[model samples]
Target: MQNQAEIQKLLVLCGTHSQTAFEQLYQQASPKLYGTAMRLLQNGELADEALQEAFVHIWHKASEYDPEKGSAFAWMATIVRYRALDIIRREKSQQNRSEAMANEQLALQQGEDFFIHELHVDEDQHLQLLQECLKALDSQQRKSVLLSYYYGYSHSEMVTRLKRPLGTIKSWIRRGMESVRECMQR
Candidate 1:
């Protein structure tokens, strides 16, 4: 790893769009940042992604770095840490949703009929209503929502599976949900 002064100087040059300085900065600092990501994410693929994203952020926001606050390495590491944390949070939420779906399926198989008893609605009817609401969505919206909520796919996964941009995937899911909510409310 480069010394703090050298890293700081490289960061300043990167802010000026100096490609050589950026390359040097990346080569010098990426190992430590990758290690930081690996420690936080505990998965090689996720750590790689976090490191890549952190570098992208650092490249764009290099000028925003303030030497008065901390060392350049610390600022870069903070970006990686936050990215890894986001991935962790997203994975946990997906796992929770998957577990809930599994529990609901298990209850149904056991003839518990919790929805009928608790919500005072026939389970079949509830499911049918939801299906109809989902069908009312545009094809892309429906697909996006199903991939995200039913299959518990992260946005990044959806982007890869559906071949859509991240913002587009998010928009489709959001609008799809809003439409479903309106339909259900009626």
Candidate 2:
């Protein structure tokens, strides 16, 4: 932790776009800010992301810091906390979407004949079309999409369960969905 005066001085220098001052400020404040993020997120990766995003904000908005209003550390910590909160809200939104998808899947499963009849499509033909579209995907993409939509697994959960990186899992799901959509349209 840095003394308030030193932090204030560093922030002032950062406002002038001094990289050295920004680096020093990051070194001084990151641990505490990261701790604040971790406390809010309870996930190391999310905390790291929040810390990085907060630092970027600090760098850009350093000129706005006002000693009369509050301490420099408090301002930075607030930024980190807000970023973590954003991540939490995004995760909750995704969970809600997953739940909705799961409910739709359940409805389809339970009312398959009625659903197909309502659509004026033969049940076997509709199922075969979907199966064929699924089979068109690469195995990894297929698995990722199925886990996400059918099992209501979050992207983070898929990363853990699939033993793949987050970006890769997201890409697989996205590409898989696009391919499925194109195939269904055909």
Among these predicted structures, which one has the highest TM-score? 1
Estimate the TM-score of every prediction. Answer: 0.66, 0.62
lDDT of 2 by residue, 1-186 (tens): 869899999998999999999999999989888999999999999999999999999899999998899988889889999999999998897677677656646655775533344456675775667767876799899878878876578788788777999999999999999999999888
Tens digit of per-residue lDDT, candidate 1, span 1-186: 868999999998998988899999999999999999999999999999999989898989998998999999999999999999988998797677667656755765686653454356665776667777876799799878877887778898788777989999999999999999999888
Clashes of each: 0, 0
* lDDT leader: 1
- Candidate 1 accuracy as lDDT: 0.86
RMSD of each: 5.7, 6.4
Q: What is the TM-score of candidate 2?
A: 0.62
